[model samples]
Target: MPGERTKYAWRREILATRAQVSPAEHAVEAAALAASNTRLTGVDDVVCAYVPVRGEPGDLRMLDALREHGATVLLPVTGEPGPLSWARYEGPDSLRKARYGLLEPTTETLGPATVAEAATILVPALAVDRRGVRLGRGAGYYDRTLGAARADVRLIAVVRDNELVDRLPEEPHDRRMGWALTPDGGLRQLGRDLPVSPE
Candidate 1:
């Protein structure tokens, strides 16, 4: 089992640093992040992403870019404390404020298994190690959610350039990411080459 003490400390350190980023700099990074991701080639599969809140990098523009790339984008409809349900993202105008300050689509709930249908899953991370270990908020929502995804699904963590660290403490329940998409680097595959490719 994973200890909450280390997780809480990492979250605090990462979030405090992110909070100091000026709005102007954050805007520039967000733009670059969107542009970099949208330019990725051969991404036509359904993309599962989140509507980043607070100091998390990227915005709904990233989701829109996925949609424009001929993908069916699914955003999370957080309910309770277990696996998350999904809903198709129509556009910016359809989002409504929900609990925890999240903006979710007004579309019908598509159940948590919807994560299994995505070829790509973009997660919000405070930091991710080169070994693909991801450091997320202490909530554990993503950990439970990712447990239901297909084995071959491409798990990508969204973070700032500095958040891609050399290592992070890992636990048994901690699901590893296959890539880290940063504001500066766009998309960089993590872990060793496994002869497999992602959409």
Candidate 2:
């Protein structure tokens, strides 16, 4: 199994792979992902989600689909490299270009603790292992934010089907995903019971 040093290598490899995905493939995957949202959370649930940037797994329509399903959606507001603040996602028209080229909601800013209001949180990951270890883009945003969420909240990492691997380097501060949502695979429950240490 790969260790901490290999994590950066994994990030580079995964990102390069994602960058090669054609627009046609991305559209198909985005449509499929939007269709699978209902299986991940129920109506009336507060969902903490993010807008896909840099060829990530989802599109804005995924957020709209959640709203159409009767759930209130919240988008992250990037601040000074800490727990993310959120704002209600009204629609595509409600978003404004923010830091790091991210689109954020134009509504009032909700505090970091607001993540606890979500019943499900759609996390962005470069890849996730069967054991629920998530590899992020080296930024500690989700790491800091997830610590403030409700313990029972569904932490689902959204990735491509191929991004779901057998194992990933794990750190003590890393928050494990309870589930993974892939375009082709839909929603899959991860094996949290699996041992964290590498064999």
Candidate 3:
């Protein structure tokens, strides 16, 4: 684990680096990620995923893949700084720019607890460590909402290949992920099975 100041610095550096990626690189990686097969699909379960904005890896392709394969995908509906609400994702046509640089659905909002139905959740991360420590954009939205998800829900972080590091600054409240999704690697288990205590 790392102190708050260290985590903040890491966030700054990682984001700066991500911002430097060229548009050509972004398109290529995004395409590869979308085309990569994750054995996670075809479960016929509710899966929670986020729409990537900025230079984040994977586009709406991940959600589309899930929906086309088997899962009934749910996307985040942003609100105040606590547990996030959700909505069924129809497609990119349904997303409207929301607060905090997020592209959210215009569909009916569902409560945070609706995440309990998810069998897997694809989280956006700047980086993730082998220990399953995830570094988000510092808003803490996922941290709050994750507690509402079923304990067994496969929490997976989505990032570029190099973004997977050996370790990261982690706090007690920072939720852990069970796996990572990369553009080339597809799905790689973080191998951290730590019990998620109620936040």
Please name the candidate that would achieve the greatest lDDT relative to the true structure: 2
Show the lowest summed lDDT stretch of 10 residues, model 2. Answer: 190-199
lDDT by residue for model 3 (1-199), tens: 3344477887888889889999999988888777753356555878888888888997888778778777788999888889989999998898999888889988999999999989888898999989899999888999998988887888989899889988888789999898888887777878653322221
Report per-prediction Cα RMSD to one decimal. Answer: 3.2, 4.7, 4.7
Highest TM-score: which candidate? Answer: 2
Q: Report lDDT per candidate.
A: 0.85, 0.90, 0.83
Candidate 3 segments exceeding 4 Å error? 1-5, 192-199
Cand. 1 Cα-lDDT: 0.85
Better of 1 and 2 by TM-score: 2
Which ranking of candidates, highest lDDT first? 2, 1, 3
lDDT of 1 by residue, 8-70 (tens): 788899999999999899888888777866654345688888898998998777878877877
TM-score of 1: 0.91
Check candidate 2 and list the clashing pairs: none
Question: Candidate 2, which segments miss by more than 4 Å at Cα?
Answer: 1-5, 192-199
lDDT of 2 by residue, 1-199 (tens): 4245488989999999999999999999999999888656788999999999999988998998999989999999999989999999999999999989899999999999999999999999999999899999999999999999998999989999999999888889999999888898888889943322111
Residue 118 error, candidate 2, Å: 0.6
Candidate 1, 91: how far from true, in Å? 0.4
- Cα displacement (angstroms), candidate 3, residue 9, comes to 1.7
